[model samples]
Target: MFFKEVVASLYAWDLLDENVDHALDVLQRETRTNSTYLVALMHDEKRPLTDFYYPHNPRRKVYWTEDSRAYWRPSPDGYERIKPRLSDSDELAGTDWMQVLIDASRARGMSVGAELSHTWIDKERTRTELADCVQRDVYGNPFDGQVCFNNPDVRAYAKALYVDLAANYDIDYVMTCVRGFNPGRGEGADTELGRLVGTTHGGCFCDSCQARAEAHGVDWAALTERLRWLADGYDRFNHKQNFELRLLLASTANITSLLVELPELYAFLKFRADSLTEFFAEVRTAVKDVSPRTDLRLNHYAGHPELMGLDLRSVAKQLDSIRSSDYAEQSGDPARMEWKRGYLHNIRRTVGLDMYFLSAVSPRPKATPELVEQGVRISAECGADALTIGHYDGSWLDCLRAVKSGLDKVGIEIRPDLPMWQRAAPALDGNPPHEIVPSSRS
Candidate 1:
C-alpha cells in the first residue's frame, strides 16, 4: 500500500469529544497539500492517558505509592481499587480512547495507525514478584521499571497486548517504539561514576542475558570477570584521587586498554542486537496473525541502530515503514544538515527502496512558518517518503500551512479536495512521483 506523503501524530489524550471537530478542522486546514495519516498513541506502557483497554488475566488494579510510583495490584476480591495517580476530576471514564480517536480520524477520511512501546512496564508493578521482569544492568541491578526482552513471559505478555490491539482496533498500521534493551539516556551512564562503571564492565549480566549470550558462543563468564576487574580497579582509584581526574584517567584506560583488549565486547553488542531482533520477530508474527494486511512500522532513533541493537536490514522485511525524528531545528548549521542528509541516505541504503521512510519534524523552541518550510524541504531533499509534523497540540496552524507550501514547491500532491468520507479507498499500490529515491552520493 502507498504511504501517506504527510502524516501527523496526535496524543490520544488530546482527542476529546468536545474538541474532535475542531482538531479535525485544524488537520484538514493545515494538511492542505496532501492526504494525511494519523498515528495515535494506543497502548502506553508507562503512564497511560486512559484506562487499561485490554482485560487483565488476574484482574489487576492500579496503585500509586507515596513516592509517586505507579503499579498494578492484583484484585482477587474484585473490590473497587483506588487509582491515586488519576485525579477524581479527570473525566475520561468509560471512554474507549483508541476506538474514539480512530473513528474520528477515519470519519475525516484519514488512514489511522497506533503506536506502542514494549520496554517500559509500570515501576510499581515491576516491584511485585508477579511482574518482576525488569532488565538488569551490568551490576545486576534492574533498570528502573523496564522489562527484559529475554524473558519469555514478558515477551508473551507484549505479544498478547499487540495481538489484542490488532484484533480490536480497526486501524491501518502499528508503530512500535522503544522496543530495545538499551538503558535510558539519564541512566547512570550520564554521570561520572556511571560512565566509569559502564566503560569497565559490560553490564546487563542477568541470568537470561547470560544464557542467551552463552548460546551465541560468547564467553560470558570470562568477559564478566574481565569487566569486573576493570571496574574494581576504577573503584579503587576513585577513592584515592580527585574524582574528576580519576574519571579522566579511568576513561582513558577503558578506551585505550579495556575495549581494545576485550574482543568479547563486540560479540556482546551483537548479541544484544540479535536479542532485540528475536523480540521484534515475535511482535511481527503477532501483528500478522491478527491481520496480514496491517502494516508494521518502527519509531526508529535517528542513528545508532547498532547501539540500540537494531539491525535494520535484517528487520526491514518484517516492517512496512520506519518513522524517524528529524528534529530539523538542529539542522540549522551546515555540518548538522550534512550529517542529517547522510543519515537519511544511510537509512535508505539500509532499508532498501520498498519500505517507506517518514521523517518527523519537531516545532519546538521556534515554530515559525519559515522553519516549518525548511524542515519539509530538508526532509524531502534528504529522500523521505513522507514527513510528519509532530505533536499537533502545540503546533501552529500557520506553520502547518507552511508545510503544505513547502511540499507544493517539491511537486508533491495535496489531496485537500478529496471527500471527507469514502465508501471505497483508491488503489495504494503505485508509487507517487515524489517517492524517495536513493541519493547518488550514497
Candidate 2:
C-alpha cells in the first residue's frame, strides 16, 4: 500500500535527445533522494509532443507523420493511413521512451507512471473527428478546441486511448489531466475580454449536449433562448455609451435573475456534472479491464469544482487518487504555506478522506530555495499522501534539491549519498503554535 512520497512530472521532449542516458542518470540520482515516482508524459493530445503508442483503430483513424506532424488521409474503400510520430534524430528515431523509463525505473528501484491528457484534441490534425465534440458557448461559438464530454465519439476515443496505455505500458499508475469543462480565460481574468467571455457563459450547448439534456428531462430550447438573450444583452451594452458600467450591470442582473428564476440552469449544471462522471466512470472501467492492478488518478483544478463539473464526492469510488496543482507563485495575499493548506482543505472536503490526495507544486521563476522548502513542508503538514513537483527540466534542479532538504527536515528518509546536515536546529518552545484556518467556498 506504499505510494510514492515524492513524484516528478517530466516532459517527453526533454528526454528525446541524444543525452537521454545523462538525463536518466540525473533523474535516477534525484529520485533516489526520496524514492520519487517518475510520471512521464506519454501522450499529449493537446500539443501532440510525443508519438502515439497504440495501434491505429480503423474506425477511429487519425494519422501523424514521422516528425510528429498530424494529418488526415482517407481512401475510397473506407480505409485510412496511419503512422507513428517518430523523432527525426537517428539516435531517437526508433527509441521508445516508455520502455526506456520502465527499464530505468526498475533498475533504480523507483516507480514509474504515465501521464495523459483527456478531452483535448489537435484542431488542425483531427478537425474532422472533433467537429461534433467541440464545446460551444452561449453565443454559439466554439470554445477553442476542447472536446465536449457528452460527445459519444470523443468519449469512445478517450476510452480506447486509455485502454491502449493501460494494456501496453508496464506502469504503476495512470494519471490523467484536463478531464473537465473549460473554466474560461487562460490569463487569469487580467483582460476585459477574458472576464466577459469566462464569467458569463457556462458552456457546451452543442447538439450532443442538447440531446443529452433533453434526455434528462431538461428544456433545452428554453435554456438556449435565455442564454442567447443574456449574450445579446451583453453585446448591446458593450457598444453603447457608459459601456463598461452598462455591461457590468447587465451581466450582474442577468446572472442573478437566471439563477433565481431559472430551475433549468441548475438542471443543466447537474447534467454537465453527471456527464463528466459517466465519462470518467467509463474510462475507469476501461483501464481496469485492460490492467486491473494499475491505479487510476485524476488531476483537476484545485478551486472551482462547480465550474469544472467535478462532483468529487460522486466520483470518489471510481478513482484511486486525486491531484490538484498548488501554484505557490499565484498565492496573492496569503503566505504560500497558508495557501497550500487552504487548497488541501478544499480537496479533502470535496473528495473526503477515503482516497489518496496529492499536492502538485509549481515553482515560479522568482521562487527561492526557502520558498520551495516552505511549500513542501506545508504539503506534509496538511496531510498530503504524496507531493509532486510540477515538472523536471534543467531549470528545476535547485528546487528539487530544496524539496529534498525540506523532506529531510521532517525525518523522511533520503539517499545516503545526499546526506542531511549532521546538526539540526533545535525546536523552538514557549511560542504560540500556528493555527490553521478552515477554507471557505464562499
Candidate 3:
C-alpha cells in the first residue's frame, strides 16, 4: 500500500471545501499515493500558521489549529468510561473528518484506515476530569500525555473506540501508536542504566497492573525493587565525575552484572511485553467481532519497541502490519540507514509481518527532496512491503513529488488513480541481506 499521513486541518483550509472528491484527487495527483490516513485526534500541541513553502491555491489557507482535541465527533454509543474532548473550532464545527474520509474513500472504492495515538490525550482535562485514567511510574507519580493502558476504564475506552470505528465506519484498518517510556535527561540518557530502568516509563504500577503481574506469576515486589535500584544507579551515574570512563562498562559489565544479580528484571520485561500483547489481543478480538475484515496495525517505534512493552516477535501475531518511520532524513545522518535497514529486515525475518516504512518529507533545510527520495529508495531496498509518507502539508509538494522519482529509481510503478486493494503489492517473503540483531533488554 502507498499511504500518506494527511492533516485534517488541511480540509478546513479549503482543501476539501471544493468537495472531498476533489481534495482526495488533488492528494492522489500530488503524492501518487493510493491510500491516506489521519490521526483520530490532534496530537500536535501547536502547529504553524503557514508551512515553510507557499500555497499554490490562493483560496486555501495553509495552517493547523493548535488544539489537542479529537478531529472526529464521538459517537453517543461509542464512549462510556472515558471520553475525548472533540474539537469545537468554528471552522470544524460541522465537518467530521473521519466521516468525510470514509465517505470519500468508499466513493473511490478505497479502504479507509483509522489511526489512534493511545498516549496522546488532553492533558489539562485529564488532570481533572479523567485523573483516574492517568498513567503512573514505578515511583507512583502520575504523568500526563499517557493514560494507564492497564486501567480497566482506559482499556474499555480504547476498545470501544476501535469497535465503534469498525462497526460504524467502513474502515479496513485500525492503526495504533503507543509510545515508549521516557529514559532520563535527554542529553545523558544514552547510558545503559537509563534503559535498564525504562520499564518504569509511564509505568502502570497501579493496583490493577500490580495484581495482574502477580496473577501472571511475576514477583511484583522484587521487580519494583530492581527498577528502583536501577533508577537510583542511573541518577548516581549521571552525577559521577568519571562518567566518560564509566560509559565503556555501562553497556557491558555494568548491565551484565545487574542483569545477573536481578533476574526479576527479565521477568518484569516479559510481563510488560505480555501485558501489551494481551491488550492488543483483546482489541483485535473485539474489532474482529464487530467487523471481521478490519485488520490491526501498529505504529511501532523501531528504535526501542521493548521500552513500550512491545516485543514485536511476541505481538506480531495480533497485528497485520507494522509501520515505523525511517530516521535517515530526519536526523540527516546517513549511518541511521544501517539501523533502519536492520529494523525493517528484522521485523520481516523475526515477526513475519508486512512492514510499512514511513518517511518524513518536509520542514526544510533538514529534509530535502533528495533526502526524502533516498529514504524511499532505502525502504524499497530493505524490502518494505509498503510506503507511508508522514504528514502532507502545502510546503511538502516538492518532497512529495520526489517520492515518485524515488519509486521510479527503485523500479516500482505507481497508479495513484487505483484503490490500494487493487494496486498494493504482496508482502515480501524473506529478510534482506543482514543478520538479525538482538533487541536489547538492558
Best by TM-score: 3
TM-score, prediction 3:
0.80
lDDT for 54 (candidate 1): 14
lDDT of 3 by residue, 292-408 (tens): 777677777546666656667756666666676544555556676576677767666766534333333332234567776777766767656567765554435576677667766
lDDT over C-alpha atoms for residue 357 of model 1: 80
TM-score per candidate: 0.73, 0.74, 0.80
Q: Write the residue-wise lDDT of candidate 1 on 79-187 in tens digits.
A: 1222212212144444555676677777777777766544335456567663446676566766655667777677776665556556667877777775466533313
In order of listing, the candidates' clash counts read 5, 0, 0
Task: Give the C-alpha miss distance for residue 240 in model 1, angstroms.
Answer: 10
| Model 2 TM-score on a 0 to 1 scale | 0.74
Q: Please, what is the whole-model Cα lDDT of each candidate in the order they appear?
A: 0.55, 0.56, 0.60
The residue pairs found clashing in candidate 2 are none
Query: What local lDDT score does residue 94 receive in model 2, on the 0 to 100 scale?
Result: 53
Question: Of the candidates numbered 2 and 3, which has the greater TM-score value?
Answer: 3
- Candidate 2, residues 56-91, lDDT tens digits: the string is 122222223232221111112321232222344453
Model 2: CA > 4 A from native: 1-3, 18-21, 28-93, 126-129, 185-202, 237-258, 329-334, 414-442
True-structure lDDT of candidate 2: 0.56
